[model samples]
Target: MSWNIFEKLKTVFMKVTQILVKLFKKTNKSTSLTPVSNVIATPTAHYEGVQTATIIAIPTNIAKAVVNCCLKNRIDLAEAIFRGFGYGNTKIVVTEKEIIAETSSGIVLLDPSKYRLSEL
Candidate 1:
């Protein structure tokens, strides 16, 4: 009789422990799944007569979008549209202001003033 009671108590205890463990696991997963912000601030250096700083921090997706837009549209049209979209690419530069990229055409300024850098 006492043995039967002990078995029942043990089963209940094990089930409660499992439930607690599952709850803790779920809580941990939920915390880990929280989204992270994407904003980045890169150090800038000033120079005279055609700034020659290398842009190594532009996001890959933004660069791809600029390249794709340039490839898909005429230079003037792409420039107009991308400028409206807050970015543009040419033979020399991708985007303007802060100078995010450069090409064989020459050095181009990736201007952060044109658009929100955080969005990029």
Candidate 2:
């Protein structure tokens, strides 16, 4: 039994050695490995002191509409400044940046900047 086991192991060792030798020869015949490139890329445009500035513009269309509505109603612009506020809703607040309208359900915020004319 010992002789049979030793013979089996010796055959397996010889087969493994042959396979390793074949793989080593195949790899040895290949070319030397190298990098693809070493180029350091850079942008052509330079922004040294560039700063972002946002200018909030007035809504000319809304202003025009308000003026027309006041003209039609024959009321002063100061008195009819909030002519379009509070019908189905509760409190409505208008400012330079946004309009806050409070309803029975929730509060709505409308940005006046988005309503401005395209040229502005």
Candidate 3:
């Protein structure tokens, strides 16, 4: 029926308008603080050493151990270790074979099997 069609159209329009409003709100908030180009440029350049990548699945227990090691030690120390591996500004990628950290200098790969999380 025409009435059902109208109701569906109305629902679709309202949903679209809501989505636009939310998007605009986010855009306005971001634009107000700094130029969009500057905001975009800084993080990418500063964190260039950090990159994200997918790899073979890592075991859950190994992932937990790495996290525990970082938590048990000061987070800063964990950062330092990553930096030593040459991943100073990069996001780490974990894999079955090793954990990879990127630095401005080059790639650092660490064996998960070798890593043992020390207790605090």
Candidate 4:
């Protein structure tokens, strides 16, 4: 029995697709760069004579990575990563929101009061 040319081509294509999928998944998927044990909350600044709430803005990717690491390691790595990035003292944090409300002027509607922090 002889295999046709189409069969050979199909087999090659399937192998190539499998390789590409594995490579892409390994590269795109999150992995812990620095070990979670080394992370710590280093204070950046202290506001004097005023009441303030610290809002740490972290990269979405990094935040997701931290969550993944924590889940795997069962440690609170997210807070450590946030503090390590110098978010110990600041207000008006920034992040990408999935549900966005925009007007004609392209202004993002971010009403913090609408969403209670305690619930989050």
C-alpha TM-scores of all predictions: 0.24, 0.25, 0.27, 0.22
User: What's the lDDT for residue 54 in model 4?
Assistant: 40
Q: Which pairs clash in model 3?
A: 49-90, 50-89, 50-90, 50-91, 86-103, 87-102
Model 3 agreement with the true structure over 1-120: per-residue lDDT tens digits:
234433343343334434544665777642211111212222222223544342122223324344444444334322322332211222344444445433333444555555556531
Displacement of residue 106 (Cα, Å) in model 1 is 20
> Residue 70 in model 3: shift from native, Å?
11
The lDDT of each candidate is 0.35, 0.32, 0.36, 0.30
What would the per-residue lDDT of candidate 2 be over residues 20-103, giving only the tens digit for each residue?
Answer: 446547887322211112221321111123211111121222233333333344444333223333222222234444433322
Q: Pick the candidate with the highest lDDT.
A: 3
> How far does residue 118 in candidate 1 sit from its true spot (Å)?
28
Residue 99, candidate 3: alpha-carbon lDDT: 53
Instruction: Supply candidate 2's per-residue lDDT for 84.
Output: 34
lDDT of 3 at 102: 33
- Who is ahead in lDDT, 2 or 3? 3
List ranges where model 2 is wrong by over 4 Å: 1-91, 118-120
- Greater-lDDT candidate between 1 and 2: 1
Clashing pairs in 2: none
Candidate 1: where are CA atoms >4 Å away? 1-57, 76-120
